[model samples]
Target chain A: MIKENIAFKNLFVTVGTTKFSKLIDTITKKEVLDILQSLGITFVQLQTGKDFPGPKLDPNVEQLCSIRSESGSYTVELEKKITLKYNEYFEDFNNEIEKSDLVISHAGAGTCLEVLHKKKPLLVVINEDLMDNHQMELAEELENQGYLYHCTCNTLVQALKQDFSALKHYSKPEKFVFSRFLDKCIGLSDGK
Target chain B: MLRLLQGLNFKNYTPRYYFIASSDTTSLSKIKELEQSVEKHKQGEYHICKIPRSRVVNQSYITSIFTTLYAILYSIPLVFKIVPDLILCNGPGTCIPVCGLGFLLKTLFIKDVKIVFVESFCRTRTLSLSGKILLYLADVFVVQWMCLKDRIQRADYIGQLM
Candidate 1:
């Protein structure tokens, strides 16, 4: 089992920059819903980028917050059981990463790195539809490192049933490698 | 690109920003976000160049070469105007023209601009097309995963900077 809170729990699912319609479609399935509930995932937030495919809202959807800018746009919603909150593009998504007990995201590099750095239990649902498919390699590599778990959209329901406690704690290297390298490259001119 | 810029800033190196973006809605929007971030978070000089995409998803290799040359032609004046000391690029079609032009400047001894290429974190086992080209061209080549560094001898594994 992932955890035994016997109380409140939060789940955050993000599809990264692009809209993975299939991801949102698969997660809302009845079977997945049952599995999530059993795992004590009470507060589930789905960040459907740009196109928020309106799922069958049998549970009355409540509007939470909405924001729009020239660069991007996002919306938030609250449901009764799954509490589906949406924020398409956050200025700083670290806040969401910090809050969530579990994060189910597409195997996008940026999202995966951030989630791993935060040391959260992440289940990456790979989008097989992508042209590049490097995401598959990334997700698998992360799994090998014991930093996160990976599965296709179809296998997400099964993947969630596995014990997450056995997963190793991720401590991403915090060394100033880039800066030190840059400093070594160029020395200041006027010596300010 | 934003992460690397922020990292450099945190290291106390005050540097200006010049972005050469591919002419795609998504790419343009991302560039705008970077511009806004520079303005909001730090008082820094920044410029954006909306250059045509050198290559798209399914362009023929012959056409790709032509488009890249075209992109270089469009970007020449801007590259000269900026004449950045260090050119940082990740995985993007825009990088080809930007880095290619920068390399030309270096070749002719017009400027000793150093190029740093970062392979996207997603790429572990192999290099992307951009990564492959930049691998030979970029003065400093960095990879996020150790497996990749092992595959390519030149790539420096810097852990995850994203």
Candidate 2:
């Protein structure tokens, strides 16, 4: 087994700008962390949306990192090999995404597009609680294309166990195909 | 829409680029980044025009009319300033007034501008609010999803732009 490299985190979980308490509650459990540890994930960065009130962790789980608190937000590391850096939100997650090995995100179209644009390994967790959620279609299409994997809150464990090393990279529609079409529409064609 | 501008081959002609930004607090910082991006990728004159939101959320019909009219008043000068050959917009409230002005310009035999409306990639099954409205106004309407072509008339089933 490879020793944990302390530079970049292995896992990044984000709930976007909305509350996803179930996702937060699910990952914070000891059993899940143990599984992640066995899989050689030494670090976790969780972006719980501002409304989760924070996870009520087990009393026996102790924090393992020294944090410099800014904006009164707590960044804690759990015991065992996995260290967790928790925050309400970053100004942007694009930089964080670049550093992460795997990303678990709520099924927001913005987040899905960003993750896919960066060519990162993505696992989307649909927020069943949202009303008239049209965002699910994007996630479904992405999964169907073999660009990403997906699961609901209940099936996160199974999703985590799935091998993603053989994923078919998402090939974006050629930049100039749409441009050439636009040129025809706008009458900028060479023949015209 | 900025991506479209970036993709254009500028060897022939360098058309003036007008990036319409929503007149909100966040737009100030975004304009800087947008300016830098446009400068890096494309060469030619570029301007960022701020258009106010057409309607405040939860606003009553009476107040909304006034706000929309106010947005139109602000948009008139920007439209004339641009005098664009083509205006490609996604589904945003700000796009409506700009496209309307472009359409008006065509009808009046003023500047000829093609108003192209590209539906947002997120809308697979149905058209967005702007798409619903622009189906009548725009000269060319494009949808990224193929399913949308069957339900909506005059919507070209183009591949995803974003």
Q: Which of the numbered candidates is closest to the native, going by highest DockQ?
A: 1
Candidates, DockQ: 0.47, 0.44
Candidate 1 docking DockQ: 0.47
Residue A135 C-alpha lDDT in model 2: 75
Name the candidate that leads on TM-score: 2
Q: What's the C-alpha lDDT at position A95 in model 1?
A: 88
Model 2 Cα shift for residue B144 (angstroms): 1.9
Candidate 2 per-residue C-alpha lDDT over A19-58 given as tens digits, one digit per residue, 9 for 90 to 100 = 8978877776766676677667788888888855655564
Q: What is the TM-score of each candidate against the true structure?
A: 0.79, 0.80
Interface RMSD of each: 2.3, 1.9
Candidate 2 residue spans exceeding 4 A from truth? A1-9, A17-22, A49-55, A58-73, A190-192, B10-42, B55-66
